[model samples]
Target: MKSLFSVSVLIPVLSISMIFNSWAQNPDFPWPEGKRMALSLSFDDARASNPDPGAALLDEYGVKATFYVVPSGMESDIAAWKEVVASGHEIGNHSLYHPCSGNFVWSRNKALEDYTLERMRSELSAANEEVERLLGVRPEVFAYPCGLTYVGKGERTQSYVPLIAEMFLSGRGWKDEAPVDPYYADMAQLTGMEMDNKSFEEILPLIEAAAENRQWLVLAGHETRTEGNQTTYLSMLRKLAAYANDPANGIWIAPVGEVAKYVKEKRAEMEGNLNIPGISRPAEGETIYLTAEKGKGIGPDIKYMPEWNAFGWFTAEDRVEWDLDLPEKGKYEVWMEWSVSDEEAGKPFVLTSGEQTLEGIVKPSGSWETFQKTKIGELALEEDFNRIIVASGEDFDEGALMDLKALTLVPVGK
Candidate 1:
């Protein structure tokens, strides 16, 4: 797994400590040895469906999954839960009563809004003890119930994440939109991508997108039954298993505990010294990329913004932003690649970098896929941590002017 990223060690070997210490978005982040992405198969709530067909299917694929369990939910399946542990799947604490927000209405009796920080800690510890008793294995990983992290309501509300951090190796949250950047992620609050009610086809793109950046993707799921609330279809699971098992995909699919532990160790080693091994820097001239689709930090989220020329064309919702790690700073040549139908020609846009702003007007570019890149005005930039924004001009509505494919920044000649 260490050999997968030669770039991870590039910085220390080159004696470039400046890039190492800073939170640089080094594109060459490594996955496990020879792997392209880190993926964790996880199910929450200790459903009885997990130990049987869930664990059984995971076994068939030679993949291990993390099961975040509730004590009471496992009462009837205690024996099966033990088998799941014996079979090498991880048992993670998912709280004793599984208290959620009062907004759920049905959970008003045991709502998180009523919990105190002390009570939350006690409940979590008691849940851990219960799992250890039933499965003879104590859990090190935790997932927030209903993806909720607070303990009280309104002004009195507080995050119980600190409590979980003290008790567990890592705590995972749900319904997150992006993958984890292991270099910067806090283990105690790792985010999980929701997998409920999704088909393998629907899930493949998420893995592919995360793999594009060589990051960790934790998928949170529930139940093996299909067509029900919070259920993940077994057929879809089988397909996901097949995709992950394929050597060609280069994904390191493991239990969350294993991945978290590995990330912690590897990061610590890199921090210690580059010669400790498996450290490298990302490649130079890496294009700062962005798209219409948004997730967590990745945005210009197409949902909240306007769409023009179809789903792929990126339009402005007032502004679009990208967090870029520029290799060097200077007057860079700007290139805007856009497609326009004759009717939607001449949309105005402003590209702002720091205090410098460059205005550009789009012209017809054949068609959507047949994009044309024209040199827009140049903007000055400083190296490292530059926020570049593309925004709408004074125009009010009338839809987007063109379909944007890519934005490029090339260094200008001295």
Candidate 2:
């Protein structure tokens, strides 16, 4: 019998009404509706000894993946790292050090914060620069050292939101929690996995389940190879590759970066669904006209919070409006562009319609920056009203030159 997976319960939590039909799969918009899954084989805190076999398996099967390279762990295996990059696998910065940064205890540790912002800049930048120097490209993916999101045991409130919005396509933290809406956490800063003592049988089911759910299953591990003994790690890798390469089994193996890109793209597409019902955005290259007041303001009934950071650590206003039109109901996403006379960094702008909200925070590269998009969650629309509002959150002053460059209402499953 085929392996069983439980997705019904998770589906209600996910509420992905726009992206796929109940039976559709693979969310590349134009791609045919079929079950599409993505699997990422990520090696955490690089282990030199574990190189040959794992890379070989991926290479042999024509599969690509992401490897998280820590400064300490990669030095001894520079050649292998280069080879992996050359072989089409992506190399991502895994932090200079791999401390358990996720825990409240460690976030408060004096030694951790002792590395000031400048030091962090150098540390993370150095890793990217070095990887580029050797691999001919700077990596855009960053995973937290031990997956720390808060400082000294207190959450940053809306802090992580802006940080991820501005930079990095995606990131990984060390947590085994069940999936939540990527919007709540930075879609780029997602959860990852570490191989514990679970056997292949127990582990395989979980991997298969995640694949079935279309969740990006990130496998993190250390010491894939020892001086002489390489048993469990090798076995696990072989199993993963076998499952990944088998499309008949519904597993779509992709590089970690690619998976992130797909998820982000899907999120944006879903956002468009939230903007308007039965009106879908044309494929890229097709132009659409948007009103100055396409996305306006929030409704009085909903609670709204400030979306912090948005630009650099402190650039421009990164404001957002949530729960804007809960009752008007319809699927929609936000697509807009803006230019300011006085360039500012780190400002947040967003639009919320139905159950979804879209955000953008960055300095405009030009008078017109086109095609920037963000995803909104699942939504249901009611009759009678059709307009949605976009604005900064409850806090922060409004922005100048904000334009709804192009907006469209997309119908799902049409």
- Top-lDDT structure, candidate number: 1
Q: Deviation in angstroms for 86 in model 1? A: 0.8
By TM-score, the best candidate is: 1
TM-score of 1: 0.61
List, residue by residue over 207-271, the lDDT tens digit for candidate 1. 99888888899999998885788988888889999999899999999999999999888776555
Model 2 spans > 4 angstroms off:
1-33, 99-110, 151-161, 179-185, 226-232, 274-414
Distance from true location, Cα of 116 in model 2, Å: 3.7
Clashing pairs in model 1, backbone N/Cα/C closer than 3 A? 1-32, 1-33, 7-280, 7-281, 8-279, 8-280, 9-279, 9-280, 10-280
Give the TM-score (vs. native) of candidate 2: 0.54
Please give, for residues 1-414, the per-residue lDDT of candidate 2 as tens digits. 421111111111122232321211123322123544456667666666445776766688897877777766767767887788789988887766543443347544433434444445566677777767766767778777666653222342222423434567777766556532332235656777665434457567766666555555676655554223323366666666776667676766777788677667766656533222122233322323343222222222211111210111111222222222223334443334443323543444444444344444534544433324333323333444333334442343433423333344443333
User: Cα deviation in Å at residue 87, candidate 2?
Assistant: 0.8
